[model samples]
Target: MASVKPWSLVLVVFCIMSLSYFVNGAGSNEGLGASFIFGDSLVDAGNNNYLQTLSRANIPPNGIDFKASGGQPTGRYTNGRTIGDIVGEELGVPSYAVPYLAPNSTGKAILYGVNYASGGGGIMNATGRIFVNRLGLDIQIDYFNNTRKQFDKLLGPSKAKDYISKRSIFSITIGANDFLNNYLLPVLSVGARISESPDAFIDDMINHLRNQLTRLYQLDARKFVIGNVGPIGCIPYQKTLNQLNENECVDLANKLAMQYNRRLKELLSELNGKLQGAIVVHANVYDLVMELITNYTKYGFTTASKACCGNGGQFAGIIPCGPTSSLCKDREKHVFWDPYHPSEAANVIIARQLLSGSTKYISPVNLKQLRNL
Candidate 1:
């Protein structure tokens, strides 16, 4: 070929690289396969098999709504995808991986990130012990560490560590179970140790949660997408229990949720400030979910007041909405898939808002703007 001018060569390179980024949305990375997640049923793909918690979705009706599963839903609490899955969609990451419990698809640890997020887990010890097999936050971190070693064996420490710290997305979504399963269930605060002092309990739990998170930051985690607790008051099951209460969710629980969020915000701020070169982003599921609850009319959700599963009074919310279970004809019209979870369609809407370009809530700097940061 004839010698090309230097400016012409530079233009060619710029055009080619721009196509890879704008069209592909996949950025330069150390080869991050997926977003590794840890926490509760909010994001659990199939890791509850590792925990002894009653807060589980490894059952029928749970996965029946997941369209991506080809009409076979996994044990996700939502009808289709959790916030994590949709978040993965926004981040250009694959659906959160169940690397810890699922058998290797191709006998490789190179699948997207592993999800150790078991349903019913919490910051408190013995939180999800009701299940025969479960994993707490500590064990989840241990899983990440073990996976690091395994990947190191496959690709060596330098490459493996780079993949985690630079390329991979790290997300954590837990804590609702701490209040729902432990403190607020049965509509009574009796027999619950946390009930001894709910306020103190929240402070302690947030502190413990922060410690676990700080540990993750220490372990080569820099690009963090930390999820705050969603609205606990508006779950269909809870509403059923408090039907007489003028649409008011339990005050104590909601107060504590807000308190916990405040603490977590403070904690993340401190963390970002302390750690150099850290990109800590808080996914505010709190208001993102509450908007669906308060503004259901604006969103075209007909039955934000009722879950689409089962029958009868508040009892149906507790009962799983399955194949035999009563379901609304139009799922897109309902905000909640079951009592405590959002429908797949609702999740998509929330995901869209979260990734909306006008606001930068998911990250202090959205991925689109992260390059300058």
Candidate 2:
């Protein structure tokens, strides 16, 4: 379980993308029927915008690069589309999955899919308590459960069950908030960190995530793509908060992410074996993001260590990107749009790898294979 070096990962990713891997691709709705998105802010389209929570991205400069939104912010926690948006496009989904809480997320809308992700949400409900009112994994699943009921009413019970189990792809990208907002909170986590070891906290996260995935399975999710935690230590927010140099990353945060990923992969494998007819793919986001961070210039990024938006910090990571935040003219040159989220350009690279790259990036099978199947 040794970590892949940055340069090594870059080479592996490049070689994988170059391979002639093929999948039977058909028309949009013919092959990949629908795509259900879960997890936190990274995949949250605009669900948090409807909530009364402080953890939201429905502000200026957040979606400045999203042309589809007419350059207006749509609650995505980035300067443009997230990985989910990019992947859905590549998978031939007609439109971005509507936020489950939105008024438009009813009736025939459930046919294409629904996004149940929430900003500041995590596998554990207590993970982002500082945000006050975010939907955790359990609650998001509850929403999905309701959507399933609606689907049954729309398409009838047998057809709804078949479509959910055989044609849709469930993509879950989450887990960063558990460490960032909960276990590592400077003031709030001191007591918990002392009372419960890192191992204990991670165990709780894994346990909750397992149940969450199982619930999705019981709800008829068959093709699964669960993204592992990325190199959180290398994010602009962590570096600025830790007062690290441009080239440095917070070692402790990276260590925690690595530890969690190791266990998460094992869990995915177990789930794939136990869950009949399930094809669980582990999305290796850690190495992919680390490569971008380490060799930004090689990938056309000018700066990977600094947020393109925000103010009053060495790396512009102290404040979240908002209406009054400083904006970057050339957002494509930056790896991050804010202290936390990746820019749209960066998400494109990540999504392409997940959709078509080799097993080194997405295990067992890539999205193309899962969709074609």
- How many pairs of residues collide in each model? 12, 0
| Index of the highest-lDDT prediction | 2
- Candidate 1: lDDT over CA atoms? 0.70
Scored by Cα lDDT, where does model 2 land?
0.89
Positional deviation of residue 372's Cα in model 1 after best superposition, in angstroms = 8.8
lDDT of 1 by residue, 1-373 (tens): 9999999999999999976643322345423445778887777887664445565676666666677786566778766788677766666554456547777622243446677888777777656555545677888887787777676665557866766676676778888888887666553445775446776777778788778878887788777767777778777777677663425565666777888888888888888898887788777888888877788879887767678765556535656566677777787788888877788878887777665533435657554343223
- Assess every candidate by TM-score: 0.83, 0.92
Q: What is the lDDT of residue 83 in candidate 2?
A: 94
Model 2 TM-score relative to the real fold:
0.92
List runs of model 2 lying over 4 Å from the truth.
1-29
User: How well is each residue in 1-373 modelled by candidate 2, as lDDT tens digits?
Assistant: 9988999989988666544111111223454667899999999999999988999898897888898998898999998898998888888787888999898998666677899999999998898899888998899999999988987887668878888888899999889999998999889999998999999999998999889999999999999999999999998888998899999999999999999999999999999999999999999999999989998999999999889998767899989999888888989999998999899999999999999999989989999888988
Error of 2 at 373 (Å): 1.2
